[model samples]
Target: MSVELEFEFEGILYSVVREFRGKAMSANAKFYKNNSLTTTGAKEVTSAIIKLTKMSKDAFMHTLFASQKELTSLSTLKNEDRKKMIRKLLGLEKIDFVEKELVEKSRELKREIEAFREVLLGEDEIKLKQEQIKESVTVKDAIAKEVLSKNEELEHIKLRERSIKKELELLSKTKEQKQKLFSELELAKNSKSSEILNQVKLSAELHQLEHKQEELKKLEPVKAEYTALQDQIKEQEKLKEFHLKKEGILKEQTLLREQYTKSKTDINTLERACEGYEEFVLNAKNLELNIAVLQESVNAKHTIENELKAEMAAEQKQIDITNAKIAKLHELGSEGACPTCTRPLIEEYDNVINSLVTVVNETHQKKINEHNKQLQNVVTQKAAFEAEAKVKEKEFSELINSIKVIESKLQDLKNAREYFVHVEQKGVKNKEELKELEQYGYDEKLHNGIKSSLTAIEAQYKHSLSLETELKRLVLVKADLENVTKKIEELKATCQNKETEFKLIIYDDVKHKHQLDEHESILKTVESKTALLNEIKV
Candidate 1:
C-alpha cells in the first residue's frame, strides 16, 4: 500500500507519489493546475504523467497529441490508465481552480500582499522593514521543511532522469538504425538481388555445371582394338601392294620363275628321300614283327620254366616226406610196434611198410630227375628267346633311327619345296596385281600415306565415338545451361523492372518497421501507465 502526496505549488494543484518494490522505485507527477477536473482535463493530466514517468518524449508526445485529437470515454481504458474527472461543485471554502491563468492571478496576489503589508505597518516604513525581517526567518524555516519533505520526490526525479537518459540512448540507436537500413533499402532497390542471394544462385549453377562436366568423362572406348583392326586391314592391303607396281612386276616374275624351278627340284629330291624313308620304315616294321614273335616265344618258354620249377618243388617235397617216413619205419622196427593201431608189429608188416617207403622214394627220385631236366631245357629255351628278342629290338632301333633320318631329310625337302611354291604363287599373284595396278596407275606415296594413317584412323574412329557421346551430353548441357540462364535473365529483368515503385519485400519491411515504431509508442504508453500506478501505490 502507498500514500499519495498532494500539495499546492505556486497556487496550482500538484500531485506526486513514490512507490518501491524491492530495490526498485517509481513515481508519477500530474499537473492539475491548468484545468478543472473534467474528462477533458484528465488528458492534460495524462500528458503530465507521461512527462514525469521518464518515457520516450517524442513517442509519448506523438501519442499524447494523437490521443488528445479527440475526447472519448475514459472508462473504456484499462485500470492502469484510470482517469476520473471529479467536479468541485459543492465546496465550503470556495477554493480557486488554478491553471495557466496563474501568472495573471499571481499579480493580483502580489498587489494584495503589498497592500496588506502597508496596512500592517501602521506608521514607520522602518517598522515594516523590521516585520519583513521577522517574516524572512519564518520563510527560511518553511523552505527547510519543504526541502526535508521533498527528499523522496527528489529521488523520484533522479529516477526519471535516469530513465529519460536510457530512452534517449534507445532513440539515438533507433535513429542510426533507420539511416543505415534506409540506405540498404535504396541499394536493394537498385540491385537485382542481395549479395548472398546472387552468390547462392551463381554458386548453384556453377556446382551443377561442374558436377555434370565431372560426371561426363570424355574417354575413347577400346582405342587399341580399333587401331588393331585398322592395322590388320592395312596389312592385308600391303600384301596386295605388290599388285600395285608394274615395273617391279618383271623382276618379281624372274624371281618367281627361279623359285618355281627350285620348288620342282626340291619336290623331286624330297620324293627320292621319301622312297628311302619308305624302305627304312618297311625294315622297322619287319623288325617289329620279329620282336613280337620272339616275345611270344619267350613268354611260352617262361611259362614252361615256371611249370617245371613247380613240378621239381613238388618232387623235392615228396622226397623229403619219404625220407622222414623211412626214418620213422626204422624207428618202428626198433620199437616193434604199429603206433597208429597200438599193436605189436609183425615181420610181414615191416616188409610191407619198407617196400612202400622204397617205392615212394624211387617215384620221388624219378620225378625229380624229369623235373630238373625239363627246367634246364626251359632255361635254355628262355635264354635263346631272350637273345632273339634283344637282337630284334636292336634291329628295330637301327631301322627306326634310319627311318627318322630319312624322314627328317624328306621333311626338310618338303618344307623347302613348300616355301618355293608359296613364293612362286605369291609372285604370280603379284604379277597379275602389278598388271592391274599399271592399268590403274596407283600412287606409291598415297598408298604409303594411307598405310601410315591406318592406326591413326582407327584411333580417330574410337575418339570420334567418344566425341559423339560427349557432344550429345554437351547438347543436353547446353540446353540446361540455356534454360538456367534464361531463368536467371527473367529473374534479373523482374528484379530490375521499373514497373513498381518498390519491391514487395522492401514495402513489407518498411511496413513492419512502422509497426515496430507503433509498438514502441505503445510500450511508452504502457510504461508511463505502469509508473503512474506504481506512484499511486506508493
Candidate 2:
C-alpha cells in the first residue's frame, strides 16, 4: 500500500502525532546539546525561551497565567474578604486578578534571574539554587518533549514511504516486463509468413510434415493450461487488495487505543500537581507568620537596650562570646569545632584588663559602628542579590515547570509513538497473518498461487494456439500433397491412351498391306491359269 505525495516544507514542516494504543509516554530527543552554547551565550539564551513561555502563558492567560491552581481557587472571595483571607493565609493583600498577573510575571522574572545565577554562582551557592533548577528543568523538558514527538513521527513516515516506494518500483518493473512479453508475441505473429510450401519430390520432407502435425496435436493441452493461468493471476490481484485493506483497519484501531490511555495518565498527573499546590499554600502561610513574629522581637529588644546598659554590658560581653560560639557551632553543625571558645573570663587579672577592655570596647564600638554601616551596605547588596536571585529562581522554576510539561507531553508523544509503532507492527503482523491464512477465502498468497497457476494455464493456452497453427499448417500442406497426387494420376492416364493409339495405327497398316499382297498374288495366278487354258484349247 503506497501513497504518492508532494510536500512543501520550506516554510512549514509536517509531522505525525503518534500514540501507542494511544497512551502518552515520554520519549528522548534525538539530538542533545552538551557543552554547547548558542547566541554567544551572551544574548541571554535567545528569545526562544520567551516565545515558549508566552505560548505556555497564553494557554492559561485567562486564569492570569497562574502556574498554580491555588489562585483560581481564591478568586471566588469578595475583594475585602479576599484581602483579609489572603493576609491571614500569607500576609498579603487581596487576591486581585491583576495580582495574579503580576505574580506570574514575577515568577517568569524569577526564573530568568535564577538561570543567570546558576551560570555565575560558585559551587557552594548551587545547593541554594537547586529548587530553582528543578523548576527550570521541568519547562525545558516540556519543549524537548514536543520537539521529540514530532521528530519520531517524521522518522516513521519516512520509513514507511521508503518501503512503499520500493514495492511500487518492483510492481512497475513486473508490469512492464509482462507488457513487453505480450508485445514480442504479437510481433512474432506479424513477421512470420503463414504461407504453405509447394510439394517437393522428397519422401523425407513428407515424413517431417507428418511429425510436425503430431507435435501440433501435443501442444493443444498446453494452450488450455495457459488460459487458466491468466484467470488465476487476476483472482490473486483482487485478494491482495482485500488483505491490504484489512491491515489498514487494524493499524487504525491500534492507534485509537493508545490515545485513550495517554489521556487517562495526563488527568492523573494534573490531579497530583493540584495536591502539591495545596502544600505550597500552607508553607507560604507559615513563612509569613514567622516573619511577623521576628519583626516584633527586634522592636522590643531595641527598646529595652538603654535600661539594662551596665548589667547588659556584662551580659552583652557574655552574650557576644556565646554568639561567637553559636556562629562557630553553626559552622561546625556537621563536624568538630572549638568548645572552650564559649567560656566566660574570670580572675584577678580582670582589673588590668578592665582598663584595656574599656579602651578596646570603645575602639570596638567605633569599629562596630563602621561595620554596621558596611553591614547596611552589604544588606542593601544582599537585597539586590535576593531580588536578582528571586527573578532567577522564578525563571528557572518556570523552565523546570515547562520541562515537566514537556516531559509529560513527551510521555504522551512516546505513548503516541509506541502506539503507532504498535499499529505498524500489528499491520505487519496482520499482513504476515494474512499470508499465513491458507484459508483460500482470505489468503492473498493463496490467491497469488492460484494466479500463478492461472498464468501457467494461459501459457498452456498459448501452446494450444501454437498447436492450432501447426494443425492449420499441416492441413494446408496435406491439401497441397493431395492435389499433386491427382495431377500425377492424370498424366499417367494420358500416356496410356497415347500408347493404345500407336498400336492401332501399326495394326491397320499391317492388315492393309497384307490385303494388297493377296490381291496381287490372285491376279498373278489367274494370268497363269488363263495362259494354260488357252494353250490346251488350241
Best by lDDT: 1
The digit string of per-residue lDDT tens for model 1 on 1-538 reads: 3445576645766664344434454443334334443222334556665565565555444444334322354446555443222122122112344553687888899999988875563558878889899998888777666655565555665566566556656666666666565565556555534544555665566566555455434333445556666665566566456454565777878878887887888888777767866667777888888899989998998888888888888878877776776677677674566645656667556675776577676787888888888888889888998998898898788888878888788779879877986887798788667666664434566656666666455655665565555555555655665665566566565545433423322333554465566556656755675575455434
Q: Assess each prediction's global lDDT (C-alpha) against the native.
A: 0.63, 0.53
Instruction: Return the top candidate by TM-score.
Output: 1
Off by over 4 Å in 1: 1-265, 332-335, 338-362, 404-418, 439-526, 534-538
lDDT (tens digit, per residue) of candidate 2 on 1-538 = 1122222333533221212222454321111123232222212332333343454433334333433564665798889877765554552444465698999999999999988985686776887699789987897787667656656654555555555556555555555655555555444333322211234533345677677668766776665566566566667666666666666756765764675466556656655544444444455555445545544554444444433344445545754765565555556543443354433333323433344456456754555555556555545554554555555556555655655665565566556556656655665666576566445456656766776666555655665566565556566666667776565555455545544543443223454455456555655655565555444334
Q: Count backbone overlaps in model 2.
A: 73
Where in model 2 is the C-alpha error above 4 Å? 1-211, 214-229, 240-538
TM-score of each: 0.38, 0.23
Against the hidden true structure, what lDDT does model 2 obtain?
A: 0.53
